[model samples]
Target: MPQPNDHRLFAVILGTNEIASAIALQLVRAGYCVVLSHDPDPPVIRRKMAFHDALFTDTAQLEDIVAERVDDGVQVYQALRRPPQVMVTWLGLLDLLPVRHIDLLIDARLQKRRVTPDLRRLARLTIGLGPGFSSDFNCDVAVETRPGKIGFVTDARWTDAADGVASSLGDVGAERFVYSQFAGRWHTPIEIGTRVYRDLVLGHLSGVPLLAPRDGILRGIVRDGSEVPAGVKLLEVDPRGRDAQWTGTDQRGRAIANAATAAVRLHAARRSTHRNPA
Candidate 1:
């Protein structure tokens, strides 16, 4: 039988978005084994930095950490045995892993709705990021993800309500986004770091042009040949036109990572105190 403290903390992050990937990298840096769960067909717009892109490429590297797609629980365990390695898998394969091995479960999906996973009972500590999760009924802790309230980790009974609007960038606001007009395979004609003016054609989806909404650097965009649905975000332009946006983790992602680290430590200390009764 495995004891509670028999091994390093094994954290399963349920999503491969930027924040989730940031958290996984942070946990690995803290000497914890991390696994990322993602969908087989992830509709992620920021393919350059998202760990979910490993689903299509089979492997992805964030900073210095590398994540490889694994097929089953055995592979996940094997990947964890190698320190600094992270495993990526779809939800079904994630469910097949032994729940006893999970020390923490962080729901970083940011779906703005109730997650279907039985996360509270799946691990010793569970965390939900953004909205749509109640600490009293869903998880042990909920971290605020809204722009102004970013990184506010709490265990209160209530959860924050999603505003359903993207955080504005200075005076640029929502004009930095470009969406597809038709559901079909997407192809990009311009490179990611290219600076472009408003109305410049960035790509096309089933013959419909994906135009730039404003003048800025193309900070992020979906990969070419991706099957996209109509109205999906296809690209993002950084109005600041800074090259730093093309590389490394963003400020918001790092803040969320810090909050998750604090939550895990707090819960681990509490559990230890309960077990030893010092």
Candidate 2:
């Protein structure tokens, strides 16, 4: 547990997806007072492996790391004092900064858009994950998440950019995911890791049917009651069978998370050099 007045470096992570959750977990272990922000109803696909459920469940855990949802800055401080529990909040990025100064800020949303420079001064060290970010352009540092698995920290230039196509397994590309066709509230009674068949109605969007594209294990789905727009991701199927583990951390997520931790250390090293150079 961390105390409000303690000297721990504070970190604000701007997403609750699995990748963001991984970064929070690693930073917390690295002794950062970490906070996560999320939408009212985040359309996250991987619930089993993400802290996104904490926003609804009040508490969610991944690989022994527990995340507890807090409503406001007051509750956030309270949650921090509880040892080993990470704080998750509905407070947006703008509202959070005024609550406390942040040492680092990470955008793990993977939105794949050219980010505005508005967030550059938000923290002492700001990091953007994935292809849409560039060092000195949008964030202070950009971490590479190209071709889906690799993660590297970049400086002085943009990391790998997207080519409008996602890397996939031999045949998994394009066929494994389901995207929304129309705009409406997403509803689903199904849980992640559930077994299903091809063409099964897994859920609905504003009363319109959401069918399973192909038979396989359900790897991810948008949260029930999420108001989504057209072109939004609805769900994903693993097609890898029921025995495949769909929970806990993913290999790619861990890589990206490790890189985020490295970025923090990199910034610290540079600061040390400037203040006490040989």
Candidate 3:
């Protein structure tokens, strides 16, 4: 983990969604400390959202959130209110917020295309698709394009691995709002959140491992552990539905029940080996 005083970078997720929370977790697991702030909107469920070290419901809690991380082992105070070198924009707030020190900006929603000009004008590194694709055009870092979603990095900043998606695929059947928002809407918030945390923000491959914890067929590795960084892909299961197929195993052809546990042990042992050399 990085020391709190090391010019620590952060991913300030603008919206109170899975994208924000996932990105924060990914960054923290990868050794970068994170501060997640969200003001609970009325009619919105207020479940405690855990990102990295600190979590809060109000902006006033921001300093305290960051402060707790400092005590635990994060050095983000070095930049004050300015976002660090790396930033993730899950929901729109880029224009409203200060960017004088933000080195890279990432737009996860893929809905706001107009923000790019302002982002570029600011000279902050950005990456995203154009207006024709999604709203996330103003990102300093973009990611893979998944028809309705765009993912990539600009100026070396990483993107969240999970793509933004609509819930209840086929439920909305071609409404203008659905089409404009790129809704086939198959993914649940938890699914997207898991992916963002494991892949993009963590700099891991898109094929990170996933355990079915039940009988299922194997899908390809979304992220192989060795090929990419810590927070890249693990693996993805087929979508749930009547037509969805199970591979009987996980991405690695391993039994799903033990995969998660094995992965943890393997990772811990690997780190232990590094720490205590024979």
Candidate 4:
């Protein structure tokens, strides 16, 4: 059980992808207690940017902050004692933890669907990201995640246009992405963040060579020993090489992070005013 602090707000972030990691980083910097919710066996391609990778490694660090995987609510309480800390847990145990203690719930799963009924009412403020969500019905706020309209926050009913295509980085969109051709366990020989040329053999999927589509830096890749299905994204290359690796939090992710932080502060202020009407 976490110690009660009327002045402190507790934020629970669902998912630990790039956008979610950015939001968690911002919220922690803003002095909110953050709990990063994730799956036990997360299939995160961008391992460097996702804190959910902590599930396998026991701990994953982003910039200066570190996320530690916890087994139960007691550990979560202990972790929260340190401000700007992150407690990682799966959904099942997450629901078992005390919900009343959560001040905000951010559904950053980017699952392209609405959250379940129980999640909508879990915290004082609930926020959903991307498509498949109606702000008026699914959550208190919805953050736009499409290419051009990224970072747009709304409280009214709104749905983003479904393009069903990944955002392109010049001609690098689909080409940069590497997928498994056969359904089986994937084995990668090249490490993430490594520089490679076009047609470079990265690894083997069901004994077939997984090659790079273009000359670029290996920015993101699935775990080496993950059981991958056919057509699953295996990795991605950044054609811009080392320059792209230095560029932190792509435009869309940074934009969404900014909006989410603003919304959190706005809601916090409203709650403060309601409690001690001046």
Candidate 5:
């Protein structure tokens, strides 16, 4: 059972992909009380995280996991009643399951065909469940949204127009839905992984000083340690060298250099976990 001050973070990492597992592991390392609930919990998955209340066998097993927590004297009534604070669904999950929350929905599976009826249905489902709830909420077949951020991870593989589609989600009544496009030439997934993990860590520890991933040439020192605020520019990433420049900022455009480095450190922690498994 966690204290009132301890964050009661619930997450569901669906699928068996390395990327999905990596994201889940990163969330666990970031101090989130995550539950990797999947229909099929593989041996590799169990071995990777050892055994944790954080990992559940499947969605149906969620009640069992919660009950176990209760037996252990953990307070999980609100968690059982409310949707998870965080959910990292794989691209495959989007095709079948209607994701539950919109406050921070992310689509990492943009490799599939776009503009299809299926895609539109998925989009509509996401929009409806996201921060802006649709009147069609009576349907039990799909999940619903709460509040916060919804995003799609993009790289060169994605068309420029995709950004417009993702960005337009904000208009559907979400407080904000962003297309987190990366401008890097190599290791796109690795970088996106780092960025998302960093932001997740920050969001979990403190509610202030949000980190918004952006595109540009980055130049800055990699600092180690916490205590960085949302407004300090820890690094510089000028798009056109010094001649033309662009700076990374929070969703609010606050310079986050110091905080940015703190974000980087979070990724490092993820790496450390991979290197030294429990």
Candidate 6:
């Protein structure tokens, strides 16, 4: 176990979606102290594949990495000592992390098609993934998340837009995703990995019943009692049944994560060269 405060590179990821969780896992494995900033109730699919549930369950594991949610600054410090296991905080990681010590900042929230604010000066290196991110404007670096180009890191001024559809799985397309029909508290008894059939009452939004679109495993869903806004993704069905993958770091996620780690490595190497030219 690598010591927390002992020269290991530290990274802060904004968001706890599966993408963020994947990046955190690879970074930890590659010898970086990683911390995630986000709340517990994410409208995230693939619950077992991410740390968004850590805030709810207090701990979530992705592959060999475990993410524990820390309540305050003191707990964050203590959690760090448990090497390779990430610690998430509801409070801002930037606020809790030492002033100006963050080596890398990654925005993995993947706010598709939304024009987010510029991420300059947040860390020594800032990387934004997926659409609406471009190097030199929104972040120091931009990584491609479009299909066929998941890990193409670049310094380009613009990136392609998301097609407004998630990649298909087990021959299932966007129809497998369930979204909130209105802004309200979401309620559901079905847990992750539960088997369900079409028309099953998976949950409700402010009393509006939500039903399954097809027969399959409940791959991911919002926590049973989360307050969710209209149009946000609420749940997903894998449709693969016996072949369903309800856990572990996924393939595309790993590609995106590898890109993040690669960008950091290149940035650190460039900085080192500039400081000590040979």
The number of the candidate with the highest lDDT is 6
- Work out how many backbone clashes candidate 1 has: 0
Per-residue C-alpha lDDT of model 1 across residues 1-278, encoded as one tens digit per residue: 33233375688887877788889888988887788887423356555566877877889988998888876777766555466567777755247457336878898877765454546887778898888776877888889999888998756655678676788765566678887666789888777778888999898888778688888888788778878766667888888855337556788889999998998888778878999996
The weakest ten consecutive residues by lDDT in model 5 span 184-193
Ranking by lDDT: 6, 2, 1, 4, 3, 5
lDDT of each: 0.76, 0.80, 0.30, 0.74, 0.26, 0.81
Clashing pairs in 6: none
| Runs of candidate 1 exceeding 4 Å displacement | 1-8, 40-42, 91-96, 113-118, 181-183
Worst 10 residues of 3 by lDDT: 176-185
- TM-score between candidate 5 and the true structure: 0.24
TM-score result, candidate 6 = 0.91
How many Å off is the CA of 34 in candidate 6? 1.2
> Any residue pairs clashing in model 2, and if so which?
1-83
TM-score of each: 0.87, 0.91, 0.34, 0.86, 0.24, 0.91
- List model 6 lDDT by residue over 1-278, tens digit each: 64655455767898888899999988888777778888333467677888888887888888777778877776655545655568776778557656336778898877775677887776778899888888968899999988778899766677678777678888788899887777898888998999999999999888889999999998898888888867788999998878898788788898999988888888879989999999
lDDT of 2 by residue, 100-158 (tens): 67788998877765454546888899999887777868898888887644787776787
Q: Candidate 5, residues 79-164: lDDT per residue as tens digits?
A: 43433322222234433233232111222122222332222242221211112122243111111111122222112122222222
TM-score of 1: 0.87
Report the Cα lDDT for candidate 6: 0.81
